[model samples]
Target: MARYARSERESLADLLLALGPDAPTIDEGWVARDLAAHLVIRDRRPDAGAGVILPPLRDYGERIRLAATRRPYPELVDQVRRPPWWSPVSNRLVDELTNTMEFYIHHEDLRRAQPDWQPRQLPAELQAALWRQVGPLARMSLRRVPGRLLVQSPGYGEFSAGSRGEVARLVGAPGELALFLFGRQRVARVQLVGSPALAERLRTARLGF
Candidate 1:
Protein backbone atom coordinates (compact mmCIF):
# COMPACT_ATOMS: atom_id res chain seq x y z
CA MET A 1 0.00 0.00 0.00
CA ALA A 2 1.18 3.47 -0.90
CA ARG A 3 1.46 6.09 1.80
CA TYR A 4 1.26 9.49 0.16
CA ALA A 5 1.91 11.22 3.43
CA ARG A 6 5.33 9.62 3.81
CA SER A 7 6.24 10.49 0.23
CA GLU A 8 5.17 14.07 0.70
CA ARG A 9 7.05 14.35 4.00
CA GLU A 10 10.24 13.10 2.42
CA SER A 11 9.81 15.32 -0.61
CA LEU A 12 9.18 18.39 1.53
CA ALA A 13 12.19 17.62 3.69
CA ASP A 14 14.34 17.31 0.57
CA LEU A 15 13.07 20.61 -0.73
CA LEU A 16 13.64 22.35 2.55
CA LEU A 17 17.21 21.13 2.64
CA ALA A 18 17.78 22.29 -0.94
CA LEU A 19 16.17 25.67 -0.33
CA GLY A 20 18.19 26.45 2.81
CA PRO A 21 16.91 28.29 5.84
CA ASP A 22 16.05 31.64 4.30
CA ALA A 23 13.59 30.54 1.66
CA PRO A 24 10.07 31.96 1.94
CA THR A 25 6.93 29.86 2.29
CA ILE A 26 3.24 30.66 1.80
CA ASP A 27 2.89 30.67 5.56
CA GLU A 28 3.20 34.28 6.59
CA GLY A 29 6.38 35.06 8.53
CA TRP A 30 7.67 31.52 8.22
CA VAL A 31 10.82 30.67 6.34
CA ALA A 32 12.20 27.24 5.57
CA ARG A 33 13.68 27.01 9.05
CA ASP A 34 10.46 27.92 10.78
CA LEU A 35 8.51 25.43 8.73
CA ALA A 36 11.03 22.70 9.34
CA ALA A 37 10.97 23.30 13.06
CA HIS A 38 7.20 23.21 12.99
CA LEU A 39 7.18 19.79 11.37
CA VAL A 40 9.80 18.43 13.72
CA ILE A 41 8.04 19.72 16.79
CA ARG A 42 4.68 18.47 15.64
CA ASP A 43 5.93 14.94 15.18
CA ARG A 44 8.52 14.69 17.92
CA ARG A 45 6.82 16.59 20.70
CA PRO A 46 3.10 16.05 20.73
CA ASP A 47 2.72 18.11 23.88
CA ALA A 48 4.08 21.22 22.22
CA GLY A 49 2.19 20.56 19.01
CA ALA A 50 -1.11 20.47 20.88
CA GLY A 51 -0.68 24.12 21.77
CA VAL A 52 -0.63 24.98 18.10
CA ILE A 53 -4.41 24.83 18.19
CA LEU A 54 -4.97 25.48 21.87
CA PRO A 55 -4.82 29.12 22.86
CA PRO A 56 -3.89 28.67 26.50
CA LEU A 57 -0.68 26.80 25.74
CA ARG A 58 0.21 28.59 22.56
CA ASP A 59 2.72 30.94 24.11
CA TYR A 60 4.67 28.09 25.66
CA GLY A 61 4.56 26.22 22.39
CA GLU A 62 5.93 29.24 20.60
CA ARG A 63 8.79 29.42 23.03
CA ILE A 64 9.65 25.77 22.45
CA ARG A 65 9.37 26.21 18.68
CA LEU A 66 11.63 29.24 18.76
CA ALA A 67 14.19 27.18 20.64
CA ALA A 68 13.93 24.43 18.06
CA THR A 69 14.45 26.97 15.30
CA ARG A 70 17.67 28.03 16.91
CA ARG A 71 19.13 24.57 16.39
CA PRO A 72 21.12 24.04 13.18
CA TYR A 73 18.79 24.02 10.19
CA PRO A 74 20.15 20.74 8.91
CA GLU A 75 19.31 19.06 12.20
CA LEU A 76 15.74 20.30 12.07
CA VAL A 77 15.22 19.08 8.52
CA ASP A 78 16.86 15.78 9.39
CA GLN A 79 14.37 15.22 12.17
CA VAL A 80 11.52 15.98 9.81
CA ARG A 81 12.91 13.55 7.25
CA ARG A 82 12.87 10.76 9.79
CA PRO A 83 9.98 11.05 12.14
CA PRO A 84 10.10 8.49 14.96
CA TRP A 85 7.72 5.57 14.80
CA TRP A 86 6.34 6.33 18.23
CA SER A 87 5.13 9.75 17.23
CA PRO A 88 1.39 10.08 17.57
CA VAL A 89 1.07 11.74 14.21
CA SER A 90 3.67 9.68 12.36
CA ASN A 91 2.94 6.18 13.53
CA ARG A 92 2.06 3.89 10.63
CA LEU A 93 -1.50 3.19 11.73
CA VAL A 94 -2.49 6.87 11.83
CA ASP A 95 0.04 8.38 9.42
CA GLU A 96 -2.07 8.31 6.28
CA LEU A 97 -5.32 9.28 7.94
CA THR A 98 -3.78 12.22 9.79
CA ASN A 99 -1.02 13.48 7.57
CA THR A 100 -1.96 13.21 3.90
CA MET A 101 -3.51 16.64 3.75
CA GLU A 102 -1.13 18.04 6.34
CA PHE A 103 1.91 17.20 4.26
CA TYR A 104 0.30 18.08 0.92
CA ILE A 105 -0.81 21.49 2.08
CA HIS A 106 2.54 22.28 3.67
CA HIS A 107 4.36 20.97 0.62
CA GLU A 108 2.40 23.42 -1.46
CA ASP A 109 3.02 26.10 1.11
CA LEU A 110 6.69 25.71 0.28
CA ARG A 111 6.30 25.20 -3.45
CA ARG A 112 3.87 28.01 -4.28
CA ALA A 113 6.00 30.78 -2.83
CA GLN A 114 8.61 30.34 -5.51
CA PRO A 115 8.52 31.83 -8.99
CA ASP A 116 6.57 30.20 -11.85
CA TRP A 117 5.13 27.50 -9.64
CA GLN A 118 2.48 25.09 -10.92
CA PRO A 119 0.13 22.61 -9.31
CA ARG A 120 1.20 18.99 -9.40
CA GLN A 121 -0.84 16.31 -11.21
CA LEU A 122 -2.10 14.46 -8.19
CA PRO A 123 -3.63 11.02 -8.75
CA ALA A 124 -7.41 10.82 -8.95
CA GLU A 125 -7.50 8.75 -5.79
CA LEU A 126 -5.51 11.37 -3.96
CA GLN A 127 -7.78 14.07 -5.28
CA ALA A 128 -10.81 12.12 -4.11
CA ALA A 129 -9.23 11.65 -0.71
CA LEU A 130 -8.52 15.34 -0.48
CA TRP A 131 -12.10 16.10 -1.49
CA ARG A 132 -13.44 13.98 1.33
CA GLN A 133 -11.12 15.60 3.87
CA VAL A 134 -12.12 19.11 2.83
CA GLY A 135 -15.88 18.74 3.25
CA PRO A 136 -15.86 18.91 7.03
CA LEU A 137 -13.31 21.70 6.92
CA ALA A 138 -15.55 23.71 4.60
CA ARG A 139 -18.47 23.20 6.93
CA MET A 140 -16.56 24.41 9.95
CA SER A 141 -14.83 27.33 8.31
CA LEU A 142 -17.90 28.59 6.52
CA ARG A 143 -20.49 27.79 9.17
CA ARG A 144 -20.94 31.41 10.13
CA VAL A 145 -20.66 32.70 6.58
CA PRO A 146 -23.21 35.40 5.83
CA GLY A 147 -24.60 33.64 2.78
CA ARG A 148 -24.95 30.12 1.45
CA LEU A 149 -21.59 28.88 0.26
CA LEU A 150 -21.09 26.04 -2.17
CA VAL A 151 -17.71 24.43 -2.76
CA GLN A 152 -17.56 22.32 -5.87
CA SER A 153 -14.81 20.30 -7.48
CA PRO A 154 -15.39 19.45 -11.10
CA GLY A 155 -15.74 15.70 -11.71
CA TYR A 156 -15.39 15.05 -7.99
CA GLY A 157 -18.13 16.30 -5.68
CA GLU A 158 -19.53 19.38 -3.97
CA PHE A 159 -20.12 20.63 -0.42
CA SER A 160 -22.56 23.26 0.74
CA ALA A 161 -21.31 25.56 3.50
CA GLY A 162 -22.33 28.71 5.37
CA SER A 163 -25.37 29.71 7.37
CA ARG A 164 -28.00 31.42 5.24
CA GLY A 165 -29.10 33.82 2.47
CA GLU A 166 -27.84 33.98 -1.15
CA VAL A 167 -25.62 31.27 -2.59
CA ALA A 168 -21.98 31.79 -3.54
CA ARG A 169 -20.20 29.15 -5.52
CA LEU A 170 -16.53 28.26 -5.39
CA VAL A 171 -15.47 25.81 -8.06
CA GLY A 172 -12.07 24.21 -8.50
CA ALA A 173 -10.15 20.97 -8.26
CA PRO A 174 -9.97 19.40 -4.80
CA GLY A 175 -6.39 20.54 -4.30
CA GLU A 176 -7.28 24.07 -5.25
CA LEU A 177 -10.35 24.01 -3.03
CA ALA A 178 -8.20 22.85 -0.13
CA LEU A 179 -5.82 25.70 -0.70
CA PHE A 180 -8.66 28.20 -0.87
CA LEU A 181 -10.28 26.88 2.29
CA PHE A 182 -6.95 27.03 4.06
CA GLY A 183 -6.65 30.79 3.57
CA ARG A 184 -4.48 30.67 0.51
CA GLN A 185 -7.30 32.35 -1.41
CA ARG A 186 -5.04 35.01 -2.88
CA VAL A 187 -2.98 32.38 -4.71
CA ALA A 188 -5.54 29.59 -5.18
CA ARG A 189 -6.96 29.47 -8.70
CA VAL A 190 -10.69 28.95 -8.34
CA GLN A 191 -13.78 30.37 -9.94
CA LEU A 192 -16.03 32.39 -7.66
CA VAL A 193 -19.57 33.01 -8.83
CA GLY A 194 -22.89 34.27 -7.50
CA SER A 195 -23.81 37.58 -5.89
CA PRO A 196 -20.75 39.77 -6.32
CA ALA A 197 -20.79 41.19 -2.82
CA LEU A 198 -21.40 37.88 -1.12
CA ALA A 199 -18.78 36.14 -3.23
CA GLU A 200 -16.27 38.80 -2.41
CA ARG A 201 -17.12 38.51 1.23
CA LEU A 202 -16.60 34.76 1.13
CA ARG A 203 -13.34 35.23 -0.72
CA THR A 204 -12.11 37.79 1.75
CA ALA A 205 -13.21 35.97 4.84
CA ARG A 206 -10.58 34.48 7.11
CA LEU A 207 -10.43 30.68 6.62
CA GLY A 208 -8.38 27.71 7.78
CA PHE A 209 -7.90 25.44 10.81
Candidate 2:
Protein backbone atom coordinates (compact mmCIF):
# COMPACT_ATOMS: atom_id res chain seq x y z
CA MET A 1 0.00 0.00 0.00
CA ALA A 2 2.99 2.28 0.38
CA ARG A 3 3.60 4.45 -2.63
CA TYR A 4 7.28 3.77 -3.02
CA ALA A 5 7.37 5.39 -6.43
CA ARG A 6 6.07 8.65 -5.03
CA SER A 7 8.40 8.57 -2.05
CA GLU A 8 11.44 7.86 -4.18
CA ARG A 9 10.47 10.56 -6.63
CA GLU A 10 10.13 13.12 -3.87
CA SER A 11 13.41 12.07 -2.29
CA LEU A 12 15.26 12.22 -5.58
CA ALA A 13 13.90 15.69 -6.23
CA ASP A 14 15.00 16.79 -2.79
CA LEU A 15 18.48 15.45 -3.39
CA LEU A 16 18.68 17.04 -6.80
CA LEU A 17 17.86 20.42 -5.36
CA ALA A 18 20.25 19.93 -2.46
CA LEU A 19 23.12 18.89 -4.71
CA GLY A 20 22.51 21.75 -7.14
CA PRO A 21 22.49 21.48 -10.95
CA ASP A 22 26.20 20.81 -11.34
CA ALA A 23 26.46 17.69 -9.14
CA PRO A 24 27.57 14.52 -10.90
CA THR A 25 25.43 11.42 -11.34
CA ILE A 26 26.34 7.81 -12.10
CA ASP A 27 24.96 8.31 -15.59
CA GLU A 28 27.89 9.29 -17.80
CA GLY A 29 27.96 12.88 -19.06
CA TRP A 30 24.86 13.76 -17.04
CA VAL A 31 24.69 16.06 -14.07
CA ALA A 32 21.86 16.71 -11.61
CA ARG A 33 20.11 19.15 -13.93
CA ASP A 34 20.33 16.78 -16.86
CA LEU A 35 18.88 13.99 -14.77
CA ALA A 36 16.05 16.24 -13.57
CA ALA A 37 15.17 17.07 -17.15
CA HIS A 38 15.22 13.41 -18.06
CA LEU A 39 12.79 12.50 -15.29
CA VAL A 40 10.39 15.24 -16.29
CA ILE A 41 10.50 14.26 -19.94
CA ARG A 42 9.97 10.63 -19.00
CA ASP A 43 7.01 11.45 -16.79
CA ARG A 44 5.21 14.08 -18.79
CA ARG A 45 6.28 13.71 -22.40
CA PRO A 46 5.22 10.33 -23.74
CA ASP A 47 5.92 11.29 -27.34
CA ALA A 48 9.47 12.14 -26.43
CA GLY A 49 9.79 9.23 -24.02
CA ALA A 50 9.28 6.83 -26.91
CA GLY A 51 12.63 7.92 -28.25
CA VAL A 52 14.25 6.57 -25.13
CA ILE A 53 13.55 3.03 -26.34
CA LEU A 54 12.70 3.47 -30.00
CA PRO A 55 15.63 4.03 -32.33
CA PRO A 56 13.74 6.07 -34.87
CA LEU A 57 12.50 8.59 -32.32
CA ARG A 58 15.82 9.03 -30.54
CA ASP A 59 16.87 12.31 -32.07
CA TYR A 60 13.50 13.92 -31.43
CA GLY A 61 13.58 12.70 -27.85
CA GLU A 62 17.09 14.10 -27.39
CA ARG A 63 15.96 17.44 -28.72
CA ILE A 64 13.05 17.61 -26.29
CA ARG A 65 15.21 16.53 -23.37
CA LEU A 66 17.87 19.11 -24.24
CA ALA A 67 15.25 21.82 -24.38
CA ALA A 68 13.96 20.77 -20.97
CA THR A 69 17.43 21.31 -19.55
CA ARG A 70 17.23 24.95 -20.44
CA ARG A 71 14.52 25.49 -17.83
CA PRO A 72 15.50 26.70 -14.37
CA TYR A 73 17.02 23.83 -12.37
CA PRO A 74 14.66 24.18 -9.41
CA GLU A 75 11.69 24.13 -11.76
CA LEU A 76 12.94 20.95 -13.36
CA VAL A 77 13.39 19.28 -9.98
CA ASP A 78 9.92 20.39 -8.96
CA GLN A 79 8.48 18.75 -12.03
CA VAL A 80 10.32 15.58 -11.16
CA ARG A 81 8.85 15.77 -7.68
CA ARG A 82 5.30 16.34 -8.83
CA PRO A 83 4.37 14.44 -11.94
CA PRO A 84 1.14 15.51 -13.66
CA TRP A 85 -1.94 13.60 -12.58
CA TRP A 86 -2.58 12.56 -16.16
CA SER A 87 0.89 11.25 -16.88
CA PRO A 88 0.64 7.82 -18.48
CA VAL A 89 3.47 6.37 -16.48
CA SER A 90 2.99 8.19 -13.19
CA ASN A 91 -0.76 8.14 -12.82
CA ARG A 92 -1.97 6.76 -9.50
CA LEU A 93 -3.03 3.38 -10.84
CA VAL A 94 0.20 2.47 -12.65
CA ASP A 95 2.70 4.61 -10.77
CA GLU A 96 3.76 1.90 -8.33
CA LEU A 97 4.34 -0.77 -10.95
CA THR A 98 6.06 1.56 -13.39
CA ASN A 99 8.04 3.99 -11.32
CA THR A 100 9.19 2.12 -8.22
CA MET A 101 12.33 0.69 -9.76
CA GLU A 102 12.76 3.60 -12.10
CA PHE A 103 12.88 6.18 -9.32
CA TYR A 104 14.79 3.92 -6.95
CA ILE A 105 17.54 3.26 -9.48
CA HIS A 106 17.82 6.90 -10.49
CA HIS A 107 17.84 7.89 -6.84
CA GLU A 108 20.85 5.67 -6.34
CA ASP A 109 22.41 6.88 -9.54
CA LEU A 110 22.53 10.31 -7.95
CA ARG A 111 23.43 9.12 -4.48
CA ARG A 112 26.23 6.72 -5.35
CA ALA A 113 27.84 9.25 -7.62
CA GLN A 114 28.50 11.54 -4.68
CA PRO A 115 31.57 11.40 -2.50
CA ASP A 116 31.15 9.65 0.89
CA TRP A 117 27.81 8.18 -0.10
CA GLN A 118 26.62 5.07 1.75
CA PRO A 119 24.12 2.42 0.81
CA ARG A 120 20.64 2.91 2.19
CA GLN A 121 18.92 0.59 4.67
CA LEU A 122 15.82 0.04 2.62
CA PRO A 123 12.56 -1.14 4.12
CA ALA A 124 11.78 -4.84 3.97
CA GLU A 125 8.68 -4.23 1.88
CA LEU A 126 10.68 -2.20 -0.62
CA GLN A 127 13.33 -4.91 -0.73
CA ALA A 128 10.67 -7.51 -1.49
CA ALA A 129 9.21 -5.30 -4.18
CA LEU A 130 12.65 -4.88 -5.69
CA TRP A 131 13.32 -8.62 -5.43
CA ARG A 132 10.25 -9.36 -7.48
CA GLN A 133 11.75 -7.32 -10.30
CA VAL A 134 15.20 -8.92 -10.26
CA GLY A 135 14.37 -12.01 -12.31
CA PRO A 136 12.98 -10.15 -15.31
CA LEU A 137 15.78 -7.62 -15.21
CA ALA A 138 18.47 -10.31 -15.07
CA ARG A 139 16.91 -12.21 -17.93
CA MET A 140 16.89 -9.14 -20.12
CA SER A 141 20.27 -7.73 -19.16
CA LEU A 142 22.20 -10.99 -19.03
CA ARG A 143 20.60 -12.78 -21.93
CA ARG A 144 23.77 -12.49 -23.99
CA VAL A 145 26.19 -13.10 -21.18
CA PRO A 146 28.18 -16.30 -21.68
CA GLY A 147 27.81 -19.15 -19.19
CA ARG A 148 25.15 -19.74 -16.54
CA LEU A 149 24.51 -16.90 -14.12
CA LEU A 150 22.73 -17.32 -10.82
CA VAL A 151 21.46 -14.29 -8.90
CA GLN A 152 20.68 -14.74 -5.22
CA SER A 153 19.13 -12.45 -2.64
CA PRO A 154 19.21 -14.03 0.78
CA GLY A 155 15.86 -14.05 2.60
CA TYR A 156 14.12 -13.25 -0.66
CA GLY A 157 14.69 -15.56 -3.67
CA GLU A 158 17.00 -16.40 -6.58
CA PHE A 159 16.95 -16.21 -10.38
CA SER A 160 19.03 -17.86 -13.09
CA ALA A 161 20.07 -16.21 -16.35
CA GLY A 162 22.19 -16.84 -19.45
CA SER A 163 22.82 -19.99 -21.46
CA ARG A 164 24.99 -22.81 -20.13
CA GLY A 165 28.77 -22.68 -20.09
CA GLU A 166 30.60 -21.93 -16.84
CA VAL A 167 28.54 -21.11 -13.75
CA ALA A 168 28.68 -17.76 -12.01
CA ARG A 169 26.79 -16.54 -8.94
CA LEU A 170 25.93 -13.01 -7.91
CA VAL A 171 25.05 -12.62 -4.24
CA GLY A 172 23.59 -9.55 -2.59
CA ALA A 173 20.50 -7.97 -1.10
CA PRO A 174 17.64 -7.61 -3.55
CA GLY A 175 18.23 -3.88 -4.03
CA GLU A 176 21.92 -4.44 -4.61
CA LEU A 177 21.19 -7.19 -7.13
CA ALA A 178 18.77 -4.85 -8.86
CA LEU A 179 21.47 -2.23 -9.09
CA PHE A 180 23.90 -4.74 -10.55
CA LEU A 181 21.44 -5.82 -13.22
CA PHE A 182 20.73 -2.18 -14.05
CA GLY A 183 24.34 -1.63 -15.22
CA ARG A 184 25.52 -0.05 -12.00
CA GLN A 185 27.91 -2.93 -11.35
CA ARG A 186 30.79 -0.76 -10.30
CA VAL A 187 28.68 0.85 -7.59
CA ALA A 188 26.45 -2.11 -6.69
CA ARG A 189 27.47 -3.87 -3.47
CA VAL A 190 27.21 -7.43 -4.70
CA GLN A 191 29.69 -10.30 -4.63
CA LEU A 192 30.47 -12.44 -7.65
CA VAL A 193 31.44 -16.04 -6.95
CA GLY A 194 32.87 -18.27 -9.66
CA SER A 195 36.07 -19.03 -11.46
CA PRO A 196 38.26 -15.95 -11.76
CA ALA A 197 37.61 -15.78 -15.46
CA LEU A 198 33.87 -16.21 -15.10
CA ALA A 199 33.74 -13.63 -12.37
CA GLU A 200 35.65 -11.14 -14.43
CA ARG A 201 33.42 -11.73 -17.41
CA LEU A 202 30.26 -11.10 -15.44
CA ARG A 203 31.76 -8.07 -13.80
CA THR A 204 32.75 -6.46 -17.06
CA ALA A 205 29.80 -7.59 -19.16
CA ARG A 206 27.37 -4.89 -20.34
CA LEU A 207 24.42 -5.49 -18.04
CA GLY A 208 21.07 -3.64 -18.03
CA PHE A 209 18.91 -1.98 -20.66
Which of the numbered candidates is closest to the native, going by highest lDDT?
2
lDDT of 1 at 151: 87
**TM-scores across all candidates?**
0.95, 0.96
Report clash pairs, candidate 1.
none
lDDT score at residue 55, model 2, on the 0-100 scale? 90
lDDT tens digits, residue span 91-155, model 2: 99899888999999999999999999999999999999999888988998888888888888899
Residue pairs with backbone overlap in model 2: none
Worst 10 residues of 1 by lDDT: 140-149
TM-score of 2: 0.96
Evaluated at residue 69, the lDDT of candidate 2 is: 99
Regions of candidate 2 where Cα sits further than 4 Å from its true position: none
Q: Which residue segments of model 1 deviate by more than 4 Å?
A: none
List clash counts for every candidate, in order: 0, 0
